[model samples]
Target: MDQNLKIELGKQGVFVTTIQELYNWGRRSSVWPMQFGLACCAIEMIATTMARYDLARFGAEVFRPSPRQADLMIVSGTVTKKMAPQVVRLYNQMAEPRYVIAMGACAISGGPFKQGYNVLKGIDRYIPVDVHIPGCPPRPEALLQAFIALQKKIDCQPLTGAERPRFLDAGAQGEFPVPVPGGHDLEPTSNRGVWPVPITMNRGE
Candidate 1:
């Protein structure tokens, strides 16, 4: 503990805690999210990081454009089948102790477009999600609440060898499987005949 933070009691002291708590506290305080935004919900997400809401208040102000540097990814809009591979690829690129918050109904369940053949039902089908924010396009307040919830969840995590996020601690979880184009719906490459071949159309004919 810092000298200023150090304290003692003649009879007892409840504040005394482990280094793991200290580390978890720090980690929870300063979560850096990726700067990747998908659609309309992105507008509300941006608002949360702005002067009014000030994500800095929660210690998560830096939004890195590179997934390698980011600690959280807020999937803020619709996730179409065409975008699923890219989404999973970005998630795989993030460093350990990473998190993902599915924001808005579109990212959560495809929203009103769930009937659309090209829309992915939800992002969680491909990558593990940490938080799910509701609303077709949730207001900035909702996004802030989601971040706060994630912080609370992070506070419960262990910093030492005892426990950690299984995805990063136990062993390599491997990359999320990217979808391949071949049928009415995209299929995993592991499935037979799912691999796609290049097609060139001769419009002149």
Candidate 2:
């Protein structure tokens, strides 16, 4: 729709919008994030919801305790190898159009714990991450920025055609596999469908 035309219509007390636009508008306006936190970053995540930051302005302040009722997952903190399965399981339980925001350095790349044998290098190995906020323990403002970014992402998603989000595509995988603990580490290491194992080419010595 043309901007000028929309304004003209508004002057006449008329409104115009398509089903796709309306649907996207509703989804972006009410993204309920799952109330799950992993480490220190969770503190900042909590602060983001407080009066100072007021995350409610973006319509994401209501954190759902159950995965089934949430559309967004803000992975805040370090994910340990032992807890990887539980995180993936919760993600699988979320309904279609689900999104994830990898918050803080730990959740994105394990931060200072990246070398720890128990810390999972990154949560992206098990599930798709829609946005990543880089910081040791990102302040509440950083989280709000990431939230807005996620909202913009949701708003731009097409309802149909090749550009449509995976959830809308009937053939796309509905659930991600939950990793299990093996003797040495999480079985399979990563979800190839989500984050493919990096291939390193070698030259003969």
Candidate 3:
């Protein structure tokens, strides 16, 4: 509905809204995050829910201990290759309409540990990340900002159409392949569909 029209209708004691609007409104309002963390960034994430920061104001205060009950996963630390598979598996267990926020430089690209053999370059290599908060360990304010950004993204998603989000698209892949530990590295390196392998062409050829 148009903004002016909605206001005019309100003046006339009338209200109208589409199902899509209602659905999106509810979904964006109550995004329960999983209560899981891996490193230093977890401290900032914890602070976000405390009195001063008060993440509950956004209606996302409820942190579920189980993946099955959560819609949001805040990967807020370094993702070592050994733990990458477990993270992906947990994501797979979450119900439809799941979202991920890669909070801090560590979760986004391993931060100072990027070159370390054990640190996964980025969690997105195995699972899709909807929001990326860039900081060694992003402040609570940054996490709140990221939360609002994710809400805006949910609000704009279309309920129907080929371009609809993966959760709403039946043909979309339901589970990502969990990488297995190989001799030198995590086998497959990255999820082909989530993060496609870069292709290079030989100029001489």
Candidate 4:
């Protein structure tokens, strides 16, 4: 091979790889979550994607029905023990680099149904959860925050085939620090009041 031709081909390869990475990043940023609403929390999940909260601003408002097409899964309601297998199957059907957001207290830790014989203790038992929104039904803003947190986690994650620092290994103690709860002394804010807030609609009468 001609030396110059070989060098040119190498440059082309590099360009293609860079372009592919950029495309992947764009797709990940604009994740379309599968809408798997099963209970009360579904209402709040819908509101988060609605005009007022505008999940579109974060590129997460696109809700897909098919698991294969969605980049993320939002478990927005109680997952019954009987429903656990189905949830796992749906999660498995999604393409690689998928994420799961356990929305609401129910999905996170079974909420008030923790004692229920039929309710799964938590959706986390069935799927690897990327974010947990804590509330009987978390406010739209809380869900949005969870999405933002998920995005941050995605950004920090190493790309495939990249050599991560040895200290960053999952088993490496101190390298991975668990976040501490700052304190619970502060009065709890009413998250319910944050939801269903009237949005100004100007419809000509």
lDDT of 2: 0.91
Candidate ordering by lDDT (highest first)? 3, 2, 1, 4
The segments of candidate 1 whose C-alpha lies over 4 angstroms from its true place after superposition are 1-15, 160-163, 189-205
Cα RMSD of all models vs. native, in order, equals 8.8, 2.4, 2.6, 14.8
Q: Considering summed lDDT, which 10 consecutive residues are worst modelled in model 1?
A: 189-198
**Tens digit per residue, CA lDDT, model 1, 43-122:** 99889999999999998999999999999999999998898888888988898778999999989878988889888877
Cα lDDT of model 4 by residue, 91-160, tens digit: 7677655788998888887799988866666766545678889998889999999988988776555543
lDDT of each: 0.81, 0.91, 0.93, 0.70
lDDT of 1: 0.81
Please give, for residues 30-105, the per-residue lDDT of candidate 3 as tens digits. Answer: 9999999999999999999999999999999999999999999999899999999999999999999999999999
What TM-score should be assigned to candidate 2? 0.94
Worst 10-residue stretch by lDDT in candidate 2?
Answer: 196-205
Best by lDDT: 3
- List clashing residue pairs in candidate 3: none
TM agreement with the true structure for every prediction: 0.82, 0.94, 0.95, 0.67
